[model samples]
Target: MTIRVVVADDQELVRSGFGMILEAQPDIEVVAEAGDGEAAVAAVREHAPDVALLDIRMPVLDGLAAARRICAGSRCKVVMLTTFDLDEYVYEALYAGASGFLLKDVRRDDLVHAVRVVAAGDALLAPAVTRRLVADLVRRRRAEAATEATPDRLAVLTAREVETLRMLARGLSNAEIATTLFVSEHTVKTHVSNVLGKLGLRDRVQAVICAYETGLVTPGAP
Candidate 1:
């Protein structure tokens, strides 16, 4: 299936550059391009693309708000674009239901791969970058007492499912989780799916957040 995408950014060069890269792929199509958050949302509404690549700091709504609206109202997945790997808005974007994020300077292959991965309904949970970002945010939230502990929200998950969530929060991919539990990757996928379904999460990103919010995983822990 062709992966239809909308590339949104305030910079014309960045927007077109990404469009060019994605358009070069045989299975990927740049369905639309937007210069700001409002246009991004509108493009998603009209195009109904498989994925929307939105810059995090767009004017007239911002990517976070656009992501929330798109993810809430449409089946389209969102991948936030940022200038920094550890952008401060990472947590908010994820909570806004973005499937993942990409740096503005992402390599051609990595950019294409990110869209494909997210289009396939997987979150871009890079252990190195994502884990540190999530952990840092969780720690800050805890310090400010802004994060109300709600570990009981995980009560609906089975013990094994809960274990799976913990591993997910640790940034382990499906295969990694499988190896850890001595189970097949298929079984790991099943548990991950069950964890998301039972917890009412949209994807692994939300599942990871849930695990942390529920105290199933702690920051700075292995």
Candidate 2:
């Protein structure tokens, strides 16, 4: 099946660049292009593409807002774009339900692969960019703890789950976790899915944030 895509960016050049890269893939097709967030939302509603490639900064509406609406309204996967490796909006985008987060200058292969990942209903966030997302979540979690009551989800995780999650949040893929725990990859996937379901998280990205929020994994710590 062809993976229909919508490219949204403030700059025509960037949008064209991304659309060009994606169109080259035999399994990919560009269904629409939007120059702003509002337009992006409209395009999704109009095209109902399989994946939406959105830029973080746009006039009238930003990618985060657009992603929120798009994800809520449709089953289409959202992939947020950033110029910098560490974007302040990256954390917000994850919480907004983006299926993937990618840098603006991503390689052709990476961009193409990211689209396929999202289309497959699997999420992806560049490991380098995950640092900022985790850091931001940790900070917000501390603030929330000071204000609201403790989240019950934090207690829902079992000890074994906590261990699996910490490794996952640290950017270890399923294969790596399976090796570390001496378990099969299928077992690791099951544990990860259970963690997300119990916590009501959308995907592994939120699971990553949860790991940091609960202090299960410290950023940059061995």
Among all candidates shown, the one with the greatest TM-score: 1
Question: What is the model-wide C-alpha lDDT for candidate 1?
Answer: 0.88
lDDT of each: 0.88, 0.84
Using all chains and alpha carbons, the TM-scores for the candidates as numbered come to 0.93, 0.88
Q: Which residue pairs clash in candidate 1?
A: none
Scored against the true structure, residue 188 in model 2 reaches a CA lDDT of 88
Candidate 2 CA-lDDT value = 0.84
